[model samples]
Target: MRVLGVDPGLTRCGVGVVEGTPGRPCTLVAVGVIRTDPDAPLPDRLLRLDTKLTEYIARFAPDAVAVERVFSQHNVASVIGTAQASGVAILAGARADVAVHTYTPSEVKAAITGSGTADKKQMTSMVTRLLRLEVAPKPADAADALALAICHVWRGGTQARIAAARTRVEEKGTRT
Candidate 1:
């Protein structure tokens, strides 16, 4: 499966695409950051982010989009911006008729590094190793985006199968 992972921020939203299945090596399709002017108006910034995310969804044609879920932060303003960006990312996937999943930061870290408390350095190192890249992706945001994609590629399939099974069971129960 191909997945597009989004680490959303108002200024520098990270985007990455990875292709693979569970328990297998994943290939990096693309990785980059979408930058918007911090000084730009809120509406303009959101529109820019939305447009870029939509373009990525079209270009990559990912089977799913894994977005970093916005969590409460000390800075309310920061959290608001991130939450808005996250919504735009999700909307992009929905507009393209692609399945969208949101994973928490801790969940991603654990999936990529086997520890929810792994630091940025460790996460970057693991992402580099897992992708078999000679060098780590530049900027913490970029690396984080790749890590998100890798996490989803490693876990999303199994989770999807489980959900499908549950739905099937529910349907059968209702019919019976």
Candidate 2:
């Protein structure tokens, strides 16, 4: 399955695209960031975010968009900016008819590193090691994006398998 993972930020929104199921290697379709100058006005940044995100969704044509749920509560400004960026990414996914799901930081960490309280360094290291990536996904935000995709693929695969098995059981029972 095609998957697009997004790490939304005001100035640099990270995105990663991969195609595959869990335990299997997923081909990296594309991975990059949408950069907006922090000096620019908020509206301009949002516009830039919209344009870049739309382009990404169109280019990758992912089945789903996995994004990190906003967690930090210290800086209201930071939170607001991230929310806007995330909103634009979601809009792009909706436009492309892609299912969008938001996962908490803990969920992502647990999925990627088998720990809900994983530190940034641990998460980064785990992502690099698990993906067999030559270099760590850079700019922290980008790594987070890749992590999101990996998390979704892992969770989605499990869910799908369980669903298929349940369906099979139902069918067999109906026949009996």
Candidate 3:
């Protein structure tokens, strides 16, 4: 399955695309950062993010979009900006008729590095190894986006199967 992962931020939103399935090695389809000027008006920044996210969704044609869930932070401004960017990304996925899933920072870290408390350095190292990249994706954000994608591919695929099985069982019961 193809998954697009987004690490949303006002200044620099990370985007990564990966294609893989559970118990299989994933291939990196693309990775980049969407940058918006901090000085730009809030509406303008959101517009920029929306445009880039829509383009990425169209270009990648992902089966699903995985976004970093916004969490509380000491800096209210930072949290607001991130939540806004995340909203735009989620909207883009919805526009494209793609399912958008949100994962907490701890969930993503655990999925990629096997530790909920893994630091950025550890997550980056694991992402590098998982993708078999010679060098880590730069700007931490980029690596994080890739990690989110990898996490979705690994976990989301299994979740889909479980849901499908439950649906089948429900249908069978209804017929009986």
**Top candidate when judged by lDDT against the true structure:** 3
Query: What's the best-to-worst order under lDDT?
Result: 3, 1, 2
Per-residue CA lDDT of candidate 2, range 1-176, in tens? 88899999988899998787887766667788889999999889898888888888888788899988876663676898898888888888887788998989899999988899999999989878867788888889888898899888989888889999999999999999
- After superposing candidate 1, which stretches have Cα over 4 Å from the reference? 163-176
Kindly indicate the candidate among 1 and 2 with the higher lDDT.
1
- Model 2, C-alpha of 24: deviation from truth (Å): 2.6
Question: Which residue pairs collide, candidate 2?
Answer: none
lDDT of 1 by residue, 107-160 (tens): 999999899999999999998988889999988888888898999988897887
lDDT values, one for every candidate: 0.91, 0.87, 0.92
- TM-scores, all models, native as reference: 0.91, 0.90, 0.95
lDDT of predicted model 2: 0.87
Looking at model 3, residue 47 earns an lDDT score of 93
Most TM-score-accurate candidate: 3
Give the winner by lDDT: 2 or 3: 3
